[model samples]
Target chain A: METRTQDTASFEVTPWEVRGKVDYRKLAEHFGVKLITESELEQIRKLAGGELHYLLRRGFFFAHRGLDSILQRIEKGQRWALYTGRGPSADLHLGHILPWMFAKWLCDRFGVELFFEMTDDEKFLVRDLPLEEANKYAYDNALTLIAIGFKPEQLHLIIDTEDIKYLYRIAIRVAKCLTLSTVKHTFGFTDSTNVGAVFFPTLQIAVAFLPTELYREETPVLIPAGIDQDPYFRLARDVADRLGYPKPCTIYCKFVPALTGEEKMSSSRPETAIYILDDDKTVKKKIMNALTGGQPTKELQRKLGGNPDVCVVYRYFQAYVDDDSLVSKIYNDCKSGNLICGECKLILYEHIVRLLQELRERREKAKDVLEYYRISTKFR
Target chain B: METRTQDTASFEVTPWEVRGKVDYRKLAEHFGVKLITESELEQIRKLAGGELHYLLRRGFFFAHRGLDSILQRIEKGQRWALYTGRGPSADLHLGHILPWMFAKWLCDRFGVELFFEMTDDEKFLVRDLPLEEANKYAYDNALTLIAIGFKPEQLHLIIDTEDIKYLYRIAIRVAKCLTLSTVKHTFGFTDSTNVGAVFFPTLQIAVAFLPTELYREETPVLIPAGIDQDPYFRLARDVADRLGYPKPCTIYCKFVPALTGEEKMSSSRPETAIYILDDDKTVKKKIMNALTGGQPTKELQRKLGGNPDVCVVYRYFQAYVDDDSLVSKIYNDCKSGNLICGECKLILYEHIVRLLQELRERREKAKDVLEYYRISTKFR
Candidate 1:
């Protein structure tokens, strides 16, 4: 029943909270990031060797801070690493996987390493969850992340509490360059906020420069994450030069709409989010009952045509459906009233169920490969 | 040229900064800690099963919180552990070793384990010092601490950055129970304070609870430190019950007076402090030039007695001189104009030089035993 709202005042986005119907362009503008232009996408397509990722091609990953500079550096034969993180408060959902999928593609194409930070500390600080629970979720999420086709050697999983001995030195360095005023302004923190929550941002910033420390070389890092996470990177970018590390380049993706058509899918609301572990029956039911732009009557939709723009089902198709031609056909067919909501829902459900089933299978096999992905304490 | 200030407004004491002349009794009253009473001293003397330590008899370790309970717990056969720490911003000085000397006494007398934290991270956050320099100081200070006669098996050295993997989990739990408002009020943190500085107290608190985590038992911890550090323990005591850990008991000492007769000796002011590594000649020169309460002329000093109560030399004698009769004779002679500043300085110089020489030799030997004193990552 939720309707999209264009009122700029109504929407909110931060690393910790997301609400209302977000206007992507306005959000980018507010965050001082640039929308990824077609020419830039063409440049990436060339770098990717004649094809762009479906997420990038569809404009799901639509914004950036320093993407052009990263591309330039790569062309000049400079090596770069990819860094991204998840606050493990709960199990992985489809919305959470969107950016990781793009990051995996980036690593596969670019032949670069990935530093995956599981911020168990952050979730423990922000959520009512226990540290042990957050740590459990971190291992669980890491298994799911490892299943997403990342080469074990290329992926270095940095669980916050486990890898803190290495991260803490760099984090304190980053923390020194930041003040309470800066974090309060950046994260909208109040006096009532716990000191752990106030200090968690430094851990995130440290991950960006971790490669430079671990490799003993100034390696540029590219982060592909949701636009909501930009603030941490923004603060990182502000302090990077001072800390003698390259400012991390970030490509931001728009939020994946909830099944109820809310701006962002959240794990707190189980009905609105489709978790990666949800069985085929659960996935089918959630998708079938999802919000769509079809008309009230099928006969009226045949005369009036349907609106594909506002439909959560169509949005899922746009993000997950691999074929450009089929997505185009679905868009056209829905607009011409040829495809009804139920048919569209069934199509999206089939794609998701298949993706989840394949992921679950790989996840079961990921246990054996977990050791290879972990960034060991001995690595330091 | 400095004079003792009785104006409460003129003196300030916090974990990071101290100024003016401190009145220990008033400071303890303001901090809501109880002054060590005669009966408490008798209880401790009975526990030692013989003579009391010179520092305890002389009232150098003056104030406490929960000492009675700790004593009662000991009588009931409940073992206790000791926790104390240093912020390794510089090499160890004579002033810095005062509490550690008492901690060694407690360990020797009571057969308790000790957790010694070197807060390199805190110094890196608060001072202009680099992390590496702070870390270097930690090692250097650890050598001196090991030389202080603690049994290697009973001592666990926790260098903040090195042991962060173990400390960080407990720290986050402590941190979650503390708010920005609380730390701001406790530590006098302002908006300009770095987030790392704000979160550093939790590391200190975690040390108090570390034995419970490491040994898997509800071990009570008692901290022996300067009165200035009470705020950190005060905050820890507030949140310990909430975290299901024992509230740490604290014994606070008055600051060791500077050679220049200032309230506290500090490393930044080299003239005021005598470094533990200072050669004998350097120690002699610093002591000879030290401020005293003698008359301007030698003839007047014979007619009018010097003030031992305000003399830095007498204070040093009281703290370091083991012979009770010798300290009392010096005090009475100064009061009766029988002892002059020169003779007293020479007597104190011999005592200090011998102490330093013995410590230096032990410190050199400490390098061999360093491995046994370190709290290894594997200990977790």
Candidate 2:
């Protein structure tokens, strides 16, 4: 009945839950993934024509399973695709879009297709949300992905329930190779777990192999996702060879620290995360009231410097701010008592408002072209 | 790990397996089902305008759940449909067609639709057959169902993987209400079972509720299936009210005894069962060698009469023979030491050969209209 063994560990991470302050190094080791190395990063930077996405530069997307093989295939000009997804349980947050942003960069740099899945069926199965509500969120999430600037031709949006005719066959193929024991071990499933939830990982695994069936070729897939999702792809990778599919490669990013300073942004606690649809006033308020490591009083903060290492505001700047020197200056200024928490909060507020404004405009246009980005297959 | 508790009960019956000499009375009692009363049979005969299918008249369909309500609905002229299916793991044997034959009668008598599902996905998951093979068999089985005389307009053929788009949403809804514990207890699922196999019951449950969605009304479903399939509908009935669908009614038939005199005819032992497509020569040979309740020699057989109660050939006659007096005459003649085993087998053989010969011609014609019977929905 005890489905997980992470109780003794300082932090727990699963596809459904993240708790406590996580140690990324130990977590990677426990998950059997290697930390991204400097050489690989340099190779990626060269592949991207001497520029790196801030996510990689800031070391946020820090672990991987088959990055070397993916890189090798890319270097040889062999075709591959970027695969990632969302659960559509709630509105997208900055944390939810982190991997998609990296996936977009991978798509642009490598000129490969991207399979973005909205697992509406999974959300419906695992949560109390109705199927219609989950499906509505799936389309809503697709708009946001389009707002993030993925090209219609390059992106294939797979909403699980809507496209299940195409997905079910592949999912069953993968499902036939998967045992309940493996799912229970990986996702911490118990007898009380709904069979739909236990069977859902196969749908996720199927997306990794979708392109192969779609294109009539053995296409390689690279998945950039939150570290919590490693278990699904790990199981996918385990069964890939047996199913005659290329093992999907993965690059995992650390969780985005919540405004309340939790290890991850959670949809359950609305105040801890800033949703993409949050109005300007809400965004400004959330950012200004965010947790920081500054002293309690202004005079005390000027005498004793703030700790950027533990500050949620600094984490946001690292994730959103593309300028390396600017981030460094802010960090140094805060650590040296030269910058106040209020000023840092205001700067982050401005950056987020500007980013969201652009996204809102693009999101409106995304609605008009939503059909173009949807996956089409002969199966239907 | 011991998935069944029927070991001490003389026979075992699950959705996937049937073993030993099944005691129908004990099995019905153990499964918490009721035997069809004489009054109920008379009501059904009246409903069919003073006649009943041979299967019902001869007590082959010996048990039921919710029959009174179904009869009441029929009396009130409320809309209802017949539901039955095949797993399509192999060629359709005579045993496989028993329920469908009963279903066809119900459809004709009531002028109601029939929903025939070929669970191709389940076959692939539970068997070593490839997906294509299962799908091929699904189409093949569909042809036979048509040959059995189900009108294309009245029959909705649901091939699992093909019609999954329509079924998936409903399946997940049912699945969300189903826990692994329920499936395990119902179907003998263990940790080593493929997750696809574990989740398959929901698809079946979805089919029972499908007409409610298709017609936008809470239509009652009457499933004519082998007793082994009772567990699925039992689980379906348990969840139906919660899902706002009518609790599907079931009429359970005792298994068709194999030629070798096993309690159930299994497709795995090809020689023990006559497939729908078996040639006249093969059918004759199988029937000639079939197990019968005859004495060691013809002289002894003539002296002591054949035992019709224990004869496999007589079981087939009881199923296929429509004339009650003729069947009674065969029984009386055999018991009175007038009819020999070979003569009785030849009579049964001639009936089957004529039946199969007409079926083969109809089956060839069924190929031309296979697409007409397939279920279509706006979901695709």
Candidate 3:
């Protein structure tokens, strides 16, 4: 599945950073995860009452570690819950919301609970930002998650600083099982790295087993995150059996591409990302300026056609275009020179503007629902 | 201050392990703490209303970091509390009780609150003990502490596993300020050391600043512990001002010597330490077998007398005998030919039996007092 493109720049990916051109298939191999097979997709489609989430159907969440184990556990009548998180180092963007949207879909389709972690503590440990600033980002990110339509009763939104008691005790046990060398090798940490940073893999790993502790049983968990985060869960899975908890299954997603098609989207690069709260005008402007794989001029574009394989706008269409037929039509039109860069930009812009306008309204309404999702109340 | 004795084995000391012949004065110098001076003792006596606790008066609690600053703050009418802790790795022993006893005296005289941390989590992280077993030790240690006559209302007994929320938020901030190099150099940690062990200094450091956070002001804290634990508070003091909290002052104690006259009394050495719960016969047997600085033969012992300076019995008398006159008499008798090893062991045996019997009674009575000291209820 791994392929190299002649014109595409090579890339590197880690939990904290991404650069150049990322190949999702190559990342899957490098991380030792399997791409979603047709059988697995059919199994999920059948389990979701004869349909699949757009993210899954379009191969956005196309990689996994233990999805088959989760399916088998479910078939045996055992329940599995979803665990995912936000680092909250910056404002929420569509890239951040993508995984949560899929998580919400899983929650509704499978009728399972969700453990949504806001790692404000990790943000402070790993970034140069102040603790208070990280806390502010956590609050802002929580609202964006609430706006994503997750059912309050089934969701446990955990802010690391506010609900640290829930994680820290178990995290110590997990940390003991982990070695400094393992983290150093896995996460590229050096002696110069802060101790908090060196110790943070445990905090991230602890979230996977939280449901088992809460329910007082060996409940299975499904962690849906970008493939970049696989190392922590891989370490968690390796230790879970020794700790007397079930190994958590992982479903990995490809990163949302940057607006300029450089690589993955990031809040640190505002010009390359579209924030969740961006206005329709702002969303349109960003998409219009976004990178695409068309020829240099209209004459060459018409004669040679375009390369949608490297187009940021085409990737957006794949992520947001719910109708499979429409997505196929957009791809056909772009490859056949039927759609120019300006036309494709218009199409992507319309979709993003509509999505943001609706999300902004829901985000305004979600303020009242935040309390129900906050797990800080469960302990305190 | 550094000295090498030809017959004395060279040793090293860290918070985790102790070896060889430890020189108290050298340890003070090595740890960058000052030995208690006559003037400071006089100030403490005046502050305690013309009396010093036996430990302070006898030079058991011998060194300090900021005792002068604490005294100055108290003179300026600023409030301060006492913070001390035990790692619950084994059963409660007199070596563990010595500092808590001194802390009790400070609490009674100055009417300050006590933060007694039972680091059950630390035991699990640092040792090969199960979390449940560590928790069991914590309960046993808490009962022994309760038996020591610290008023429940003025004491807050925090078990790290049970009251983690209070410590973790602050610990993260402290952890962030610490670097891997600092901890590795300070704690002598290697790559094989678990992440929990590498990260635990912050947990220990956080207790020093908890009073400042809880009281929401510049409340000073006094940590009374063995000089071995000085590194954690030293690191705490380095970070406290930047964190906007008053630096914690320390009153360090010399290690209580083992019955074998080895440098330290350790719970890991069952034959060396006298457990508070040891039966009367067991206590007498241990004292009878204890090492003494007497001549090989009774005839030579009578002619040459004994060295009370290095005798375990004389040190025990110093630790347990409340009356200064009684301790002086015992010292003088041992120095001259007036007291022999048999008579000294008998006298020490009688004192330990009485002390243990009284403690056993108080321990039975203390079951009812534990509820008031536990901070678990504050969170639950």
> Scoring each candidate complex against the real one, what DockQ results?
0.86, 0.85, 0.79
Candidate 2 lDDT over residue span A237-330, tens digit each = 9889998999999999999999999999889887899889899999988988899999897777889989999999999999987889989999
Q: DockQ ranking from best to worst?
A: 1, 2, 3
lDDT for position B227 in model 2: 86
Report the Cα RMSD per candidate: 3.5, 2.4, 3.2
lDDT of 3 by residue, B1-380 (tens): 11211223577777877778888787777777888899999988987799888888778888899899999876776889999998886567778888888888888988888998998888998877898999888988788888888776778989888788888878888988888878887777877788998998898889899888888777889999977787788889899988778899999888888998888887877889899988888888889899888778787777888898888888898888798888888778777777889988898889888888888898888887788788765434
TM-score of 1: 0.95
- Indicate the DockQ of the complex predicted as candidate 3: 0.79
TM-score of each: 0.95, 0.95, 0.94
Candidate 3's C-alpha runs over 4 A off are: A1-9, A294-307, A333-340, A378-380, B1-9, B295-305, B376-380
Q: Which stretches of candidate 2 lie over 4 Å from their true place?
A: A1-9, A296-305, A335-338, A377-380, B1-9, B377-380
Question: For candidate 2 chain B, which ten residues in a row score worst on lDDT?
Answer: B1-10
Candidate 3 docking class: medium
TM-score of chain B of each: 0.95, 0.96, 0.94
